[model samples]
Target: MEKCSGTTKATSKKRNASSTEASLPDCKKLKSKDGGKTSSNKVQNKEKTKMEKVSSKKKHKFLGSTEVSQSSKHASKKKIQDGWLEVTKNDKGQLLFKDFPQFQPNMSPKEVLQAGSFGGTYFRPIYSSVTKQHCEDEWKELPEDWLKGLNVPTQVASSTYRDRVNTYKVKCGGSLEMWESSGWIVTQDPYGWFQWYCRFYQGRRTKDDERQIGRWAKCAGVKGRWRNNLITKVVRSGCGFDNPTVSPVVRQTLQHWGYRLTKEDYKEGAKRVKPK
Candidate 1:
């Protein structure tokens, strides 16, 4: 089973907008020729120009780097942005294909993390500096905000997979060993679907995207057996959507699969069931 995952000191010396005009000889000359009135006007003009420049720089910082469109040229380059690194080419220098159409997942990697999928034990054996560094690099590539309320793996004991961290507060999936023996583990995404989803969301399109996407589609898509059957069973019971007792196991299962059972889904299923 796939377990889900500053200051600038320069202003001190500078007083006010007048300081800008004070440095300009033209303004001094204008003041000498036109008296205090023209000096005021020039100062206003200089201040406006200064404000504009500052505003432009702020916008540039806010926008950051432009995302290069995925193309043949960019295939060999590695683009690092936010907290993650993107390598389009392998060590062999051959382009890994990522031509799948954009698939907008219902939940983002951050949302899943905050929601507490994977029982906090997903990232295990992180005690060593080498392993810790590997985990740090992965988490760093994501938005810094997504990790605010999370449990950072500190020790092998506490960080060991705890079902309490999951949204359902229960273990819902098989162990990594089971997944590997079942042949569900892909070498590219050793953690399974959730890992693939996270990497895919990060824009690291590899030769494995299509296969991974296909696997997700089969498991969680609308016609998915796991989801549709559970919805049918829950709705027929006439239990309210908010009812925690309604298929908690299946709900946890879906969450592990990177999908959540919304009230709308429950209501729709209720509509289909004949009242018992």
Candidate 2:
């Protein structure tokens, strides 16, 4: 009976050891599964973070391009505004010089006639008369001797004559005989002369007058070369004569004068004498 009891106790201890071994294997398998799941989650989280960073960088790049485009547009607008302002300022400032004493009105028909004479060589009278009419009030009258000193002919009868006497005759209702007797040639048609007259007096006269004269000058010689030469002479002389505002006759006269005349010499004349 004692042997049997000892054997039974040994069998029970073996069974208990077997049960512990089985439970230890189950615990180790559960731990391994949990570790694997955690590692997979960590990898997913890392990938998600990298994708988010890439998306954020792309957004920043796109936004930077938009900002740069807007800035460039704003700068361009600013430059245009500045240029406009400069033009406005220059125009406004020119008004102050309107009252300058050197300003003169367009010359009269009688002055135009005298300017064509052999003894009356200075063509300013003829040019001023035909081109500028509005500024008459501002001009200081000149003396008679001013022309004599310049060595200009009192009567110009050749093709090179600066005065468009024949033109004036046709437009002003003078007889053709009068033009012939005056030694004037009919180079420009009446319409051409009228256009020239209108342009020669543009800014100094009314816009209506300017248009009228421009049409006439166009009739006489609408070519660009003639127009450009007229403009060049006016600019170089600094004669205060706006080339765009005068008749062809006046333009021709100014061109001739520019070839021989100097601004300094004219200024001296202005100082010494007043326009009659």
Candidate 3:
């Protein structure tokens, strides 16, 4: 569903999820036929603040009902403070943790940023609601290789939210206020889930890991509601797995969660849908 090219390129140092050390292909602007109305009403695009726009028009529920675990414990401050970041990947394109198999994210943080997510403002300066501290350059804590080739101002930490920076060219998630109000902003990664993910990918284990992984599962796991919902829509639309016009908003949401719907995943979801 995400077909447009991004502004920056980043390569993985570890063996790529593609079973080889392959660089991510440059995603150029994809040609489309449906005049951009690829999704049903569920994926309609409405011009709104980048953080406020929801993928679904009907009952746009975000971090609402699912209660977040109030986690005060976290990974050793010593290791994180010592500045250690190690990134690895499973050959299957899914980062699988043996202890947390339910948390299988295909994209690395580098891939996610390179794919153009979060309106290019995810790591921007912010006064955290959880930490109550003005945090700047916290993104620098991430692996430099992952942040390579990224424009810090416009691509990594833009003060302003630019929808054009997103590969989908559509806003698809809830506001930061919603995240904080929902009690999902843990102090360890006050910016949000993706921040936690970047650290987690680099061996920063935390007590908050389970809760964060559960959230990722709810959004992108095998039976993840958002993931499954988008798959069903794809099956209903009868589009190819990479159809850019189909549910761009939902695709963008999944992208932020570090999962992209693959052809194999689409076919598998179709079988389950057909049986129902």
In order, what lDDT does every prediction score?
Answer: 0.57, 0.34, 0.72
Which of the two candidates, 1 or 3, achieves a greater TM-score against the reference?
3
Tens digit per residue, CA lDDT, model 2, 41-100: 566689999998976665445423312122343442332222221111122121111322
| Model 2 CA deviation exceeding 4 Å by range | 1-148, 151-208, 212-276
lDDT of 3 at 176: 76
Best by TM-score: 3
Each prediction's RMSD to truth: 16.1, 33.2, 24.9
The residue-by-residue lDDT of candidate 3 on 178-210, one tens digit each, is: 999999988767889998887677555657888
**TM-score of each candidate structure, all chains considered together:** 0.57, 0.18, 0.68
Question: Considering every candidate listed, which one attains the maximal lDDT?
Answer: 3
Q: Determine which window of 10 residues in candidate 1 has minimal summed lDDT.
A: 1-10
Arrange candidates by TM-score, descending: 3, 1, 2
In model 1, the clashing pairs are 83-140, 83-141, 84-141, 121-161
Question: Model 1, residue 194: what's the lDDT?
Answer: 77
lDDT of 1 at 259: 67
Which sections of candidate 3 miss by over 4 Å?
1-78, 81-91, 274-276
